[model samples]
Target chain A: MSTDLSRVADPGSIKLYTTEPDHHDPITLRSIGFWLYMMSDIMIFAGLFAAHGVYGDAYGTSKITAAQVIDPISALFPTLFLFSSVLFFGLAGVALKNNDRKEVLRWMTAAFVVGLVFVLQEIWEFVKLAQEGAVPQASAFLSDFWTIVWAHGLHVIVGLIWMAVVLIQVLRDGFTEAVVGRFLNLRIFWFFQAVVWVFVYTFVYLMGVS
Target chain B: MAHHQSSPIDHPEIQSASTLQYVSAFVLGLALMIVSCIITLGGGLSQSSTLTWIGILALIAVVGQLYLLFKLDLSKTMIWHTVSAVLTIPLVFISIVVTMWMFQYLEMRVMVGGS
Candidate 1:
């Protein structure tokens, strides 16, 4: 209880955390809420996947098969691009941890560019499929494919916008606590997209072709 | 800095990022994609077996990203994330398996052969 100052701080010190003096860790809810949203997002994808499972091969005497329409190899390039984005984003996450503002910005730019390419490639695929008379109305199989894949594409676009906003926040504000929370949730969102894409590649591309 | 106003980076849940692991995970995922393409296009395996191998490889890739990228171990920091992610697992299988069964049953009951 000495009032005298000491340069020597206690070793092995730890403190219980609270977000605000009177608010019980409202920050944790930012992440947890995003986590829950991701769960519900999973259910949305699950419904789409179920539709694919049900209608994918069940062309119901229609001449079109998923195999004839989908180019599995088209997905591979986008896979490489998007997964690389994830890697870059992971690097950005580390940079954010170190509070290296420049590194965070650099890696985030890389991630955003790569993600943009992936989205462009996806759009290209959609155009080609549409020109080939493979619109959603063509078959239940096509309907499910377009719905599920476009749903994912929309998420990626939203993620791209979120990332842009967060990137600006980081560039403008440095690693403030609020910025960190948004970035963390966006990391989860970005990562979950990659995860969902893996399944899409396997089930939609590889399985569709094989 | 005041004791209560500590850095968010100081939190126990925020593990130091490993560049090597993240790169390795990326490489592993890319390798799996190549292998899947080979399996499908190389004419090595029958279609059924190709699908099976691709499924296995995809699972490996998913688990790799979760472990390497997200650092989703059962560490104290990852408990909530781990639990929430785990909660989605059963739902995935249920959606897939039940959909397959129901569709197969529906096809059997209603439709033509091999369309």
Candidate 2:
């Protein structure tokens, strides 16, 4: 038998039909992928929370409780900065949708600034705490508190880098489909960080106050 | 090569639909952030029970933010994602509570016995 060269040579004639487009919806894929990454980040926080719970009362034969170490007044500014960062991310999302490249860059730049401010506030808080004899090794409460808060601060730093990357992409490509998809994904991730911060501020900061 | 007749990005309806989503996300995110700030600072220092209530309220705000900011919903395409998040969050909460409770119990026991 002659080799079936016709079918093999004319692959385009095979007529493979499907309702969906050949390319995956980049926005959807990016959204889902970023979500998965967020879940993984949540797991990291969960681990820290578990550690806090385990060592919550182990203040090394001392009476230093959670209430004594945390300063609610000092926490307020960083919380405001984090919330503002969320708003900036929202503006970036709006800019992405409007296909306004310049606005996207501006919003993301604002978000980065807000995030940096939050990080600075956190460092100041830590320094003040340390000055007040609340070092990480001073007591179990201090250790757990620093671990959880710093872990979150590290995440915000990573998010700022991610935003910077997206900003560069927008500057290079404008509002092209790839850039838009990436920006949306970054927005989702950044918003998730804000959500986690809400829990951190409420349970960790506010609860520690009383 | 011949040019394509139509592009999905050029579809006016699809363009408007995505724009609406973006707008909604912005409005909802801003509202939730303000609400959370008020709840945290406005709620004066109180007992554990009152603080717990505030925490619950903050959690609600976070859910709203996630829904509007990320457009995370339990649609068919996103069911698994929603389910995993819902389940995992509760697990994290329970783990924290139980661990803290255990530590508190042990501390109390040591105090009573040692005294």
Candidate 3:
């Protein structure tokens, strides 16, 4: 086919054919920023894990071993909650891809609820352990145990609050680009929390019990 | 850019997998959990060697879940995740092992001196 060179040379038509890419792609920037933040947080967990590992058995005289300190039954519920939240967040991602704002909000809300449940379960577990004489001050193992687990629990609490704020924002403004970007970042954060929990659960509970 | 949006269940990547794959993964995960629980609760495997093996198995199970359940691809972006995870595991394990060893050594020295 012969192309119309004259038609393509129209100056006004050329004005509509600009090839400049949009520079305001906040989603890409936010994703990269969130990944950086996750890496930093991973470093923080690394530090805590190292600290706990080094000081875990400093006091060897205590009757409350790591096995005795961790209640598997109490931990199981929270583990389930956190894992389910990851699934719900995956659902939220799907909802966002489909441009379903209502479903996005619904899944996010479910995730937030699950997160809250996890935090509460953790709190209860800690309290029960303390009441049963597994106090942090009782031994170095207990101290390190409480510190690592409590730090993770605090992260869950913060994540729950973050989810709530994002939920409110989405409810008020719907799924704007900024909101979706933040939502995606928080989803990554939530998944990272779950990832860390697997280690904590394995090392602290499983290894401790063994 | 051409936008290719598809429902999660209808997505080609997800749809290509047989349901049995998912079911088997879930069942295997549950089995791992049970095995971990048994080792921990059986109260017969408290020695350092047994615990070490249990820990290694638990770590493997965690990796398995990440691969099977989450389907985390080892793509460019995921390389960092894998690297950090691998590095962190050794760091944590070595620290714990060294500390426990030092503590036991000190206890032995104290006993010898007291005798």
Candidate 4:
């Protein structure tokens, strides 16, 4: 295998840089593979979303409905904060464009902090819901609601942990090819979270109330 | 991979990042969300109309965010990612829509009067 590391002319989507496709480029392979995983992950979410649609009004044996439990206007706060985190992550991508490690770290830290706020708010929302007897055990409607929303929250928490690890890696190791590749994949993950949230707030909270 | 040290900036994906795009997407998303909340909370519209508006706003938010933040454009660096992501849309629709349809039909046949 020729070790010529010249930039690939065709510019495969996630490739870092390589003229020849003879050997597996670690970053490129990892990113493309990770994205495929994300696609499958989204399909799982689709199933959950579909389940929610079917069980949406199944408030069996309970007097409460989704509107009684979820407040669409109040839900906007966490949504905005989550969107802010995405913007911060995108800014980190721009920082990466300039290869400015300090800027990247700063923006990533900002993203992490904002993301933390979002997760905390969501946890509080769930806490309040549980306190109001809106637990997943309450009804099929609440079950579906909690399941889908919790799934998204779990991903956010995982993303935050991943962000912390990436921040530490960037601080300790600087921007090595591996570190940058991991950051790239994390960016995609973070962006995907916001995309899913758009649907959650729209389909679950907004339309649920309506 | 270890022998060749390259700046991450040189990568086309990173190069595609635009501060302007991200900022605009954020602003657009925020504006749309506020409008949606207003429409939902104001109770000025019927339930169906409110649902329709929310769906429209959500679609706009999705498209804006996908294009700007995810950079799912037709550019050479993003074409593969874009194509793959787009391909999944139909599957999402089929899964969600088919399930809803099945349940709706079941309700009509099962219940004396449909919900």
Ranking by DockQ: 4, 1, 2, 3
Q: Which residue segments of model 4 deviate by more than 4 Å? A: A1-24, B1-5, B112-115
Model 3 regions lying over 4 Å from their true place: A1-24, A60-63, B1-31, B43-46, B64-115
Model 1 per-residue lDDT tens digits across residues A1-210: 342223235433434575566542434567778888999899998888888877778675568888888777767899899889989998998887777889999999999999999999899988988998888888788888899888999999999999999999988887777888798889889988888998888888777878
Which tens-of-lDDT digit does each residue in B1-115 have in candidate 4?
Answer: 2323366546666677899999998898888888888898899999989988899999999999888887787775567788889998999899999999998888888883334
Candidates' TM-scores?
A: 0.87, 0.76, 0.72, 0.89
How high is the DockQ of candidate 1? 0.52
Structure candidate 1, residue pairs in collision? none
Model 3 agreement with the true structure over A68-175: per-residue lDDT tens digits:
676664566666777777667767766766667898889888988888888877788778888898898888778888888888888888888889999899899876
The candidate with the higher TM-score, 2 or 4, is: 4
Q: Ten-residue segment with the worst summed lDDT in candidate 4 chain A? A: A1-10
Write candidate 2's Cα lDDT for B1-115 as tens digits: 1122143233221232244444554455445445544555675645665566766667676777667665557664466568767777777777777777886788687874232
Better of 1 and 2 by TM-score: 1
Q: All models, DockQ values?
A: 0.52, 0.26, 0.19, 0.61
Model 3 per-residue lDDT tens digits across residues B8-92: 2233222223334334444554456556666777777646866676677667766765565444466543455556556565665
Give the Cα error of residue B59 in candidate 3, in Å: 2.8
Each model's interface RMSD (Å)? 2.2, 5.0, 5.7, 2.2
Query: What TM-score does chain A of model 3 get?
Result: 0.85
C-alpha lDDT (0 to 100) for residue B75 of candidate 3 = 57
Task: Give the poorly placed runs of model 1, Cα more than 4 Å off.
Answer: A1-26, A60-62, B1-5, B111-114
